[model samples]
Target: MTTTTELRVATDGLTKRYGGRAAVDGVSLTVRAGEVYGFLGPNGAGKTTTLRMLVGLVRPTAGTATVLGRDPGDPSACARIGVLIEGPGFYPYLSGRDNLRVLCRYRGLSDAAAESALERVGLRARAHDRFRGYSLGMKQRLGVAAAMLGDPDLLILDEPTNGLDPAGVAEMRSLITDLAADGHTVLLSSHMLDEVQDTCDRVGVIVAGSLVAESTVSELRGGTTIVVRATPYPRALAVARDVAGANRVAATDTGIRVDADAGVAPRLVRALVGAGIEVFDVHSSERSLEEAFFDMTRGSDSTGDDPEVSR
Candidate 1:
């Protein structure tokens, strides 16, 4: 009972090969319109290859992909999508406004759209400045403006925050969230799991060119560990053990750490109180997306598995 409107991007058995090896193997993914889909993986995990195929930069060696109901490489399909691949490219001597104008000209748009695009990226005040004079963050924003020129329905950005300071990273994250909120479908690829977890509505993780997990942030954090602190460590440990199915219950310097199922926090509190343990504080230790990424990608070398091809 799925509707066409529910799917913005779809791939089936997508594979890409190089020589005798596969750069991307039989991978399939679907993204809905207005949904922020995150592609996570380590370097050389085929994330870039998959995105290239999705954008028609490289033809798949084996599988098929569609964007907005048409082949990604189709000129009509490409027109509806905006992409900021690698980093933003511009003429060092050209003003920000001029750079966008150049892009618009190539896309068959009037120069009027260039100014508006600059405004959208919060660079209106500095629109006339040469690209060489802008900071790394400013350059990144300009790149985003270029991508927004056609007012495309879908946006694909890869590591948009690369080479930015902490504040720049924060700003980029906010801008991305705002883009999605404004009804733009975004497909983001990043090695920074924390950024992805914070910004994306759903995440698909790849390891060694193979999809290892796909889920919402909440679903991925379903069984996170909760750390409980009490006056007496041993007493807390004993009470934690009494709680049914408390795995890895151990006494730490401050209190006891236990891995338990979701919705068991309240139950643990009551059990500890009933057992006469002096409970000082209770808190859940949710795993950050970075932690989750490590857990998912650990023990696998980047080149361990042969790549898959999609034509």
Candidate 2:
């Protein structure tokens, strides 16, 4: 549903070299408007460096990048992009509300902006709590609230859920969803594969400073598969192959896996039942993003990555 013109972030052959080694090498990716785009990679995979380039904190050594239709770091573009890279840094002694108010003054924004941001991130109830006293989740939410100060069109968050507990992560995920629903574009970078798989509409996987894959979670995982658990294993196998085609049917540790759609489940069950095989259960399955990610970047782990390059 997103057109080329709606792209909020686009890079072509973007590169950044630290001394002789390239932290990010010839990377090209896109972030569409109003979508939760995940920039996924492992630690030292150059995710942070790439984000720094996107937000103008660091310059790219080669190639080009456009943020919000303007060159990265352009004042006009920067005004429209809110960033929360590396995490929030507020005066520990200041109240959460006061911290935002300070940022408001520094940015020449009104105190009203601070109040609105607090309410947006559900921090208004405890807005008066000291920064050092707030829970980890609350601190992260306050960080997001700081970024939301101007109601910018794009939010560039780097591992917002880095050190949170389960409940904290859930809260951050909900906040992201709400931001996108309100027509904001979010470019979320994280090394956490499963979290990215759950939260992102589309993801670009970076490995060893190079982009290996970019696509929707389901697309990257490939097609649907029908998994059937049945008794009389041999009979069930034969029946499944006959019904779903031998090439598509493969035996798994627990059951038979058919590389077919859910529509084939009924026919498979029926065939097994008629063949005197007791069907225990039948369901559709898909390859997980984690499996696909490891498949694409298999050997990179053991080889290790450059320590000089940041995540």
Candidate 3:
């Protein structure tokens, strides 16, 4: 567990209910400062409600959350947070710059902050373009700029890459990493597991409105699997199965997969070679984040989130 001093976002038994259906239930999360935290779950998994609660957009039915050491609903604490939730929503007829200027007026910030935000998101050139005329990526950038106008230390972004092309996704990825490097804590909610694996320092997997796993990206990778390829396939599989402490050794179309880390990699290779099997290549790697995610939620269902409306 991360120390309380380093925690910028903390929730205890957090829950939300619409009617009698629990959108979120007993969710506990701790996000440390200076880390890019990835929040992932399938559709209708209560991700949005959880984020909304953290940003004070939605009130929790039970439990509590603290942001920047104060109640999440506290006006002062909310000011310290920058949120880009439910994608970007701007006045379509207004220029992007004008839209931000309006937001600045509401926040009591000067035009300079708006300009800086535009520049940070690489939208200064298109700032004068009407929001309705902007591409999906441009609109997404505007959301990021709005979030930045506060000069906040914490950012909560939901599906920031929803409409980005490959290049745009790359740009957003770099931008997010830059934010973390600058000592800003970020909570990124997205369905892109590969992007999460590459960008986030830690990840929290939610299924059925509850966090099933929370750990650093590397730690989340969990056990390593040694993949082997050799000339003799059947014999190699036989040898792999005989190796002591070797977890799940199964054969694949291309090669055999051995559930063992690097420490036991050499042992597997040595055993195969000693068994008169010509071992060509042997490498160990953690299962992909996507694979692990599916495995975690294989039996889970959003059916549990049935919200029967009650006053």
Candidate 4:
């Protein structure tokens, strides 16, 4: 069981409205300590709004949210939480290291904190490069490094990999993973399904201002099922049904689909082989995060007055 102390962030029916329409409607989610939690949604969904409310950048129209056991925007809580929302702002003339140093000073932290943050984000080598000359990926890394200035307990990152090349995306993914491994609770919001699938321990999917699903990457994608193909179609089908209960067996276009794990695959092959059915191919099929997201938000579509616009 999860205790309140174990939760880094918790929201109950948390909502935000723009005029009459809701930008975030009744979202209840939890982020545990020292885990990477992904907030996933299509563009214009309520992800940003929900995050803003948690960080106290925006007030909730209804419901309650607790960050590090305090109200959103609480000074004490804010001190313990690091945030990087949208694009980061840094002076064009300032070096990456200097940029973090300025933020550190604002936070009442020492220059050493800035240097430590730069090293953590792999920006130590380019520490002296001006912000204007940095690549988009480098700038994003610097933003994250700035967020790490004080070694805050939680990081609330909104679209950390927004506009990056494939290599940059991979680097960001690795950095997020590294942060989580170092015992920092990370709340990452992104529209990229594959990135979330690869990086997040669990995910909350919001669609059209509503959270429709929340679960681990594996659970959301569903369990693995065995697909079998054999020469004797009819015989193979019968053997599959008998081996893996009739209810768990279904005939596909080429062969049989067994609603069972890979452990049942060997048994299935043996049974078919014993029955003189030549097994052609057998593999396990598991849905991707993209597939699961589509399944969860099949009918939802975003309209005017989104969270970003309202912000």
Candidate 5:
């Protein structure tokens, strides 16, 4: 009997080049079982290209990857892969149910597969609605449902929430989260930090076709700036600087800011209070995933650094 490894996807030095331009350059990353993994990058950041290679829609120009412990090009492995990359094509005249039925037939899946897929995406009621009549959000949901036709072990979605409005975005987020909850391994790629931060268990950041960083959202927010409000601004500023062991301290309009971890909050409060400074409030401006992204990717062009920081 073959024992299944925990890694759902593993790629090492995965490179793809078009002409002389390197689209995906030496990206090494791993996605473990039963987690919603986020592949984040701006447009043309090679996120789509990387995903295309994984699903065997496009062959890798260089490097290697394994999906379900089999080569990506292996047809047997392809059967265990589900994709909603780009936007799915649906026959405009066919109802959603019929569209899914057609896909099921193509994949040689059963009618139960069609029904379960629609139900999973919460589109069972509208299963009979015409494909062309679907709203942008509905179209996205149907695409997801169609991808579930095979009930594959790994689901790879490229920019699944790209064009949706706020409500649609939230719906897509809910659907992705629910899939992960059902013990499905999902790999979703998007440019939206909020979507990934909300939906993913871990995120790998791509920039200029490089895997620049990979970590959980909380771990990405590693460098937090503590904001402290105390009477006697200068003295409080000195206390913050001393406590945080940081020179990147600045006086805000109402308080002082010091670059440090959230752990420094208590020490900051105690020091100010001990120094007879009236401590009013202390909070960490807590570096957001987006903020950390820019900070890490800043001057990436000049530095050409592929720093992988994980916890």
Candidate 6:
């Protein structure tokens, strides 16, 4: 299938400041249409600030952003975009459907569109329930439904799976994927590296309010690190020590722990055999997305170097 290359969103030197402190420093990103773009960062890493800027909840300090080829802060631009920030805003006494109706009124959507939106998020059965009685996951679903109400071309969700259980998280992930399959561009801001790695086609990692890395998950993975079990620890350790790109080589009870660069497993195995060691098993230690996230932002902390404190 041929994929279209539409620039759904773009930022140039986007920045935000609070009380003389830079919450989100100069950053640039692009989310292409029909793509699920993951924005990843740790707590206080400015992911929220950036999203707020994109949706015009907070104005940028010194940069510009565009959504769907127009200024994101413009009222017309808002019509083409849907955002779910923080939590869903709903009247406690209003029924779920009624809440959506109010939002539709604000956006000039018809009653029929409201009903369809509710059905899209699987809340049609509970549409009559008051917002106060809904569970967290239900509220989240309703939030997404509200965002989808306008048939928006772009959706920006911030921490969409904040307080959900495992099953709810799975459902949300699947829902986002389905939305992308339906041709809506999605910009998902999340702190969960594994979730982003699983759901996103492309990712932009931010550390201390700056963009550190941008790439596909496979590219970020770079290579595999494999663990091998072998006899004769001393000889194995010697061989591993001499292997180039070996980050760590240590003696273990059953084998030697080796951290080699990507694509070095086969050569490592052969080296062990050449050293007269009996190799029992070879297993690849795939680095999780969390590990990769850490590796990318390992030393970006703003605090001055303190030998006593560990990151």
Which candidate should be chosen as best, given lDDT against the real structure?
A: 4
lDDT of 5 at 91: 99
What's model 4's lDDT at 76?
97
lDDT of 4 by residue, 169-288 (tens): 888899889889999999999878899999999999988888888899999999888999897798899999999999999988856889888999988899999999999899999899
For each candidate, give its TM-score against the true structure.
0.87, 0.90, 0.89, 0.94, 0.87, 0.83
State the lDDT of candidate 1 residue by residue for 1-311, as single tens digits: 54776777888889888887777888888888898999988777888788888888889889888898999888988898988877688999999999999999999999989988887777899999999999888898898888888888899887777767777678778888988888889998887777888889988888777778888877765566778887566766777887845456877765677787547779888988887778888887777888788888888778544343211
Residue-level lDDT tens digits of model 3 in 111-209: 999999998878888999999999988999999989988788999999988888888888889989999998999998999889999999999988878
Reference-based lDDT, each prediction? 0.81, 0.87, 0.86, 0.88, 0.81, 0.81
Query: Worst 10-residue stretch by lDDT in candidate 2?
Result: 301-310
Q: Which pairs clash in the backbone of model 3?
A: 19-310, 21-307
Better of 3 and 4 by lDDT: 4
| Superposed Cα deviation of residue 130, candidate 4 (Å) | 2.7
lDDT (10s digit) by residue, model 5, range 164-206: 8887788789988887888889999877887777788899988
Runs in model 5 lying further than 4 Å from the true structure: 1-4, 246-254, 259-263, 298-311
Looking at model 5, the pairs that clash are none
lDDT of 6 by residue, 1-311 (tens): 22223788888899887767777788988888899999987667787778887887788889988888787678888888889987888999999999999999988889998899887777899999999999988898889888888898999998888777888788788889989999999998887778898899999998777888888887776665567777776667777778744457766664666666657778888888988899888776667778888888887773322111111
Question: Which of 1 and 6 is ahead in TM-score?
Answer: 1
